[model samples]
Target chain A: MSDSPDSAKKKILLIDDEPFITSLMAMNLEDSGRYEVREQNDSLKALETIMDFVPDLVVLDVMMPDLDGADIIYRLKNDARLKHIAVVFHTATVREAELHAHGGIISGFPFLAKPATTDQMIEFIEKHLPK
Target chain B: MNSVPPDSPPPAQSTLQQLEEGGALSQFASSIAHEVCNPLSQIVLATDLLAGPQPMTDEFRKKIITFLRQGADRIEKAMKSMLQTCAPIETSMVAEDANVLIETALASLTVDASVRVEKHFASDLSSILIDKKHMTEAVAAIFANALDAMQPSGGTLTITTYAKVFTSSEREGWQRQSWFRAGDHAVVIEIADTGHGIHKSQMPLIFEAFYTTKVAGKGAGLGLTVAKKVVDLHHGRLEIDNRPEGGVLAVLTLKSAAKPATFLSQPLP
Candidate 1:
């Protein structure tokens, strides 16, 4: 294994049911040169992909069938192995105020709204990722 | 008007005042709540499931919270309307800045990143006397309806304000019944969206209470009705025109204090 930090890239796991948004985020994140992106479109298979990828950061979409994003967070928080990884939420369910109120339990986790600009998405990922 | 005997007491005498009034208001509130509750309930159940002990991983919690927040916001709006209608007015009415109100309401919208929100405020326009809360709600309701008509596809929304003059004679039906005076100053705000225009037949019942074309559980048809009530409270006029380019144009006209009289405003044909 190469021990050089310069050549190594941080991987990111994206779990979203929507192909459009997920693909858009993946493309933008990949272009940012800071992340290696792995996507899981279905929430049910999200854990397997996360476990396999062991990403440095996780970006989750809220509205999914079987295994939604919030549940994924609860599980990640409890799992000691995955607990250290940073998480960012991307959703368009409500405005900022409502999100702020409901984001009470998920301290320190970053959030980005859907249909966001590439710059906005990149900024979120950069801010939440460990240096 | 003379059908009732001159010695007869008012209708209040025949009905139990508190029971009747409270019953009617509660029914209206319950109906509105019922309409909003469907979506809200889905969110709550979804949130509860997300919060359950079944183990939600780090990847999924954010999404569940978003759904719950949105659902709560919807219910809050409905509850706000109910409270506004049921509670007695305590604040004095005054001239309010239409531009400010519209901007405040638009800020709450979850406009897609692709969609651009544009506003054109008339600098010389006079302010209209109205309740700030109700006026804001009415304008917001119109904008919300417009957004629903244009969401996902993402398009530009233009809200414009202007000052105009209208004579009472030009206004008819409800306007005439309400005794709109000639030479009244009028302030108009138009919210134009880029979406599928309203159908012709739907126009007739657009303002009718409990009338909506939205899919079942999507809307209670109270948006326009509550909006109309707010407009009535402000002595204003609300009009919806289907634009040829494919969208709904909502025009809100409120009485202003100073404008030279022109042709009477024509009612919707």
Candidate 2:
């Protein structure tokens, strides 16, 4: 039997402090069959997980304990090995209307406001995924 | 002829009042929105999974239902906390021992065994006019915050009560705050904790509703807000500052119901 083109799924890493959120999101994305999802609930260990997983894309929550999304982005951008991976912020820190007004981009980075529909998240992920 | 109404406040005062009210309303609304978003996100995601095209096992179904319930419960809890904090307090003031109130507050909480509590109540401490129930809640809130700061590393929680007569110099130092007058006898209750002190930048917003350093689900961020409100209703002053020797100290000063004796003459319990 020959392998299908869709069988090679894109790898996505989700970093959020909320366990339920990461769990539900991973399940939903993996169910779609277009992606393989990994969840990291600890923001402190996010970098280590990213390095080991080497996911194609990373979705992070903005407000986290110890280290925040921006701090992680700074570290990622500074590190040559991790700089090339795509990053998107999934946050509840900003209002959904504000996110929309900014065209889903905050501080020169892609953003998806919390309570977003699965379609919206998938669309955002697809749009921001590295080509 | 004057165009402004005779009973109206001065233009500058009115403007300042407006600004203060507007700022409070804005902060409250923003806090509610932000706090609700986390639970809402969970609900949306959970529902999305339930409606997904994937085959659902019995385990997955049970998990999703649990997630939905958890999310709903969180939202309900946050709303209840917000309402309780924002509600207008109806206080019945009476002369009560400050130490008793602190004890009452402490008794209500389940203080961890790792945290040691020390009380240094003044033998000559005067009773203060307070709504006992509300004041106890305020003190408990402060205690809770102190404990939270210590977290996994428990520390000593020191509570001290003393009485003082505010002198003209002290009044001037406080910028003639309406809460106290010169020569007024006041009882001071200090709740100090040997925990990581709050950051200087965050001190201004600490009392603001839903402004918390704790991770989501750990708090609704209304504890200090409610505490401050209760103190304000009693015309008392509540000040929280980082102690020099480490940790944070919360000083609550309320008007003494009776003439306070010379605290220097009394022995500490």
lDDT of each: 0.63, 0.80
Q: On residues B1-269, what C-alpha lDDT tens digit does candidate 2 reach at each position?
A: 11222232112222123226646766577778777888899999999988877778899799899999999999999888877765556666667878888888999999998899999999787777777787898899999999998878899999999888878634312223334666888889999999999888568778878888887799888889878777765657899999999999999988776675455456888
Docking class of 2: medium
- The lowest-lDDT stretch of 10 consecutive residues in candidate 2 chain B is B1-10
Query: Once all C-alphas are superposed, what RMSD does model 1 give against the true structure?
Result: 16.8
| lDDT tens digits by residue: candidate 1, A91-117 | 644323223433544434666655456
Where does candidate 1 stray beyond 4 Å? A1-131, B1-91, B174-181, B210-220, B259-269
DockQ of 2: 0.57
Model 2 misplacement above 4 A: A1-7, A78-81, A95-106, B1-22, B169-179, B261-269
TM-scores, all models, native as reference: 0.46, 0.83
The true-versus-predicted C-alpha distance at residue A14 of model 2, in Å, is 1.9
DockQ of each: 0.02, 0.57
